[model samples]
Target: MDRHSYMSFYNIFDKNLLEKERTRSFVLLNIGDALKNHEIEVYYQPQVDARTGKLCGAEGLARWNSPKAGLMMPGKFIPVLEAANLTYKLDICIIRQIARDFRKCIEEGTPIVPVSFNFSRTDFETCNPYEELQKAVKEYNLEPKMFRVEITESTLMSDPAKIKEQMTLFRKAGYEVLMDDFGSAYSSLATLRDFDFDEIKIDMGFMRNFSDKSKKIIRPMIMLAQSLDVHTLTEGVETAEQLSFLQQAGCERIQGYYFSKPIPYSEFVQKLKTMDCCDDLKDCEK
Candidate 1:
């Protein structure tokens, strides 16, 4: 067979195989019902100021627990939902849940620091996506600044003009914008130029290293953001040494196990209680 005929045969076989793999149909199995049924839970990871031990913010990571699937992370099914044209519904579900959780935190007398959520490029292209955000905030009586939305460099650089416009609207609405996983892509600086980000999150790879080369890679990004008056957040900071490096480099915040790992809502509340009690003990010692 010729090259063209062989390529056509391969394409047909590949399509058939992929369609068969999707036959289990996880996406079509009433994901909305699962969310409504309270099968989904949002996990909170705290972000702390490096200079002070105070909690500056938190990031919301989604998890799902179904009677059928037991437990799963967003990476397992979010892409499937997106491929099935159900991402908008999934996004709405997540936002509404986050709003409800924010209200709960407020009621408990914990200061409601901003919590960040990831948003895909497809979400921005949806008609009146900002309106959906507005309604959620209004309904929950949540301040727009009480939440941050994180976007990755890959999405922002794909269409600079459009992402810039959408992001400006987010800023005007009092939502903090964070460029997540910075330095992971070549388009990082381009995206930074195209939009006004309130914060930039350092990619974890450099966080795993404290070598001279790694310091060289990280310090420039922090300096660049500081010059623009944007806060820099470092992720995957699991050791005191890493936290010290980030502080020396002038990173605005450090997140990860040098502080504490992401915990269940109940556990997080308990953690706050323990910290408060420790403060009282320190005061008594003083």
Candidate 2:
């Protein structure tokens, strides 16, 4: 990831945005080539069935390997991409990449598990993401079951009417739509009422403040999902105690540092081959 190899990529940007310049555009100038050259990648974090402790699905998180800055996390560059009105571009890149990766896993005879991807609310407004995504999935000659779409609870709060339409469209297309960051915002109940989510990702912020009180809050969330016939997956599960409690509380799936951090798809495929998910998993950090 050396910029010197593609120094001309910087020439397209205003000199002020170049590496070592004053602004954050250092990240911006890298996006086009990043997507074209495959520097921006989708990393997979394993989710396991709580009861059986086995690999069930994964979340495909975007990671940018900037030639200028080594590797960049989503939080660092996503907002910049958003402010520049280019967020939709990056989101689509990840979706298309996931389709290819999922297709590869299938052709190689790997156990096919669904991989969920997040879509920013801006995506709904900026483009016909639903149509574009459907095309990508179709192009790969894959079924809808291998692809899952995750939407943040807050994204719905921004535009419930539009969000509702999206929820219905995706579900009708035979794709499972997940409510991501369930408890992070105040509109959880409202979002739940208006839309049908296949799964609920109870926000990890609740786990950050892990306590007796938070456990009480989490318990009901799982029960509520069960009542609605929706599966539950809790994020930020980083310890034996948390895993044990989530399993006992009847959560269907769990993802966090307890099992592994997000790793490249190649490593994820390797882990899938050997991962037992049998309570003896040590922390994975690659």
Candidate 3:
């Protein structure tokens, strides 16, 4: 290629990259505005007992309701937020929403099962998670047990000392700490020993090929958690067969579309009410 032609092509490529960066910056700035104006929302997905199929708890997930873009899933916006260094802000917003919702449920006489929220690695590195959480709980007059914190195994690997300190702080504040996406990382067992997590959630990938061979690995992991007196929960369970296998393998809790998908706050409250009524009726029949 001629020198002038190569220079022209390089200039065009650089201009395109610059334009993309500007677009990303603009979108992230708008997301910050959405957070301030309460366009982002917290949704809950229920978790149930593997043996009894009763409502045990829920996991709090984030959603963005953009007026321009309609509803957006976390996958759509979380990376943008992280890249923009705004995850700590988003995490605080989620915690505040969960606290407010828990308060509202209590006032209306609804059952308040524990709800868990995910914390990014940046959350630990940049902020005082313990004090931030304590302030949120105090603002709502809620107990610590009403909330659980989920940290991914990979996140824990980022800085073991800091993560351990944060985990210790969480437990000291009366919140249960759960290791999420356990098998997805290389050092799952190492974290299990080095940290004081109350529970370990097995990654859902194992269920894709949940044959005897898979069980040979999973069953032992569950048993190891049991041996340490840490509870076990499995996510992404979608069928009776999968649920049955996890149950037989001694998984303590399960969450997935097999029971229900993540729903809005109002629908989740209604479902909880319906489940409570059904349990009452079953007791009457007995």
Which parts of model 3 are misplaced by more than 4 Å?
Answer: 1-23, 277-286
Each model's TM-score, in the order given?
Answer: 0.84, 0.87, 0.88
Tens-digit lDDT track of model 2 for 70-110: 88899878878777778889999998998888777666755
1-286 in candidate 1: lDDT tens per residue?
6766654333445876676456337646858678779887777888887877777677887788778767877777787776665667767777888888777866676545567888766676664556787889999877887778888887687577787787889899888889999999987887788678999999988867657899888999999999999999999889877888888989988888778877777776665555422221121111
RMSD values, in order shown? 5.4, 10.2, 4.8
Could you tell me which 10 consecutive residues in candidate 1 have the lowest summed lDDT?
Answer: 277-286
Q: All candidates' lDDT scores?
A: 0.77, 0.83, 0.84
Error (Å) of candidate 3 at residue 239 is 0.4
Among all windows of 10 consecutive residues in model 3, the one with the lowest summed lDDT is 277-286
Q: Candidate 2: list runs displaced more than 4 Å.
A: 1-23, 276-286
The TM-score obtained by model 2 is 0.87
Residue pairs that clash (backbone atoms under 3 angstroms), model 3: none
Between prediction 1 and prediction 3, the one with superior lDDT is 3
- Per-residue lDDT over 97-190 for candidate 3, one digit per residue giving the tens place of the 0 to 100 score: 9999988987787776788999987887778778889999999888888789999987888798888888888998889999999888888888
lDDT at 145 for candidate 2?
66
Error of 2 at 184 (Å): 1.1
For residue 202, give model 3's deviation from the true position in Å: 0.7
- Higher-ranked by TM-score: 1 or 3: 3
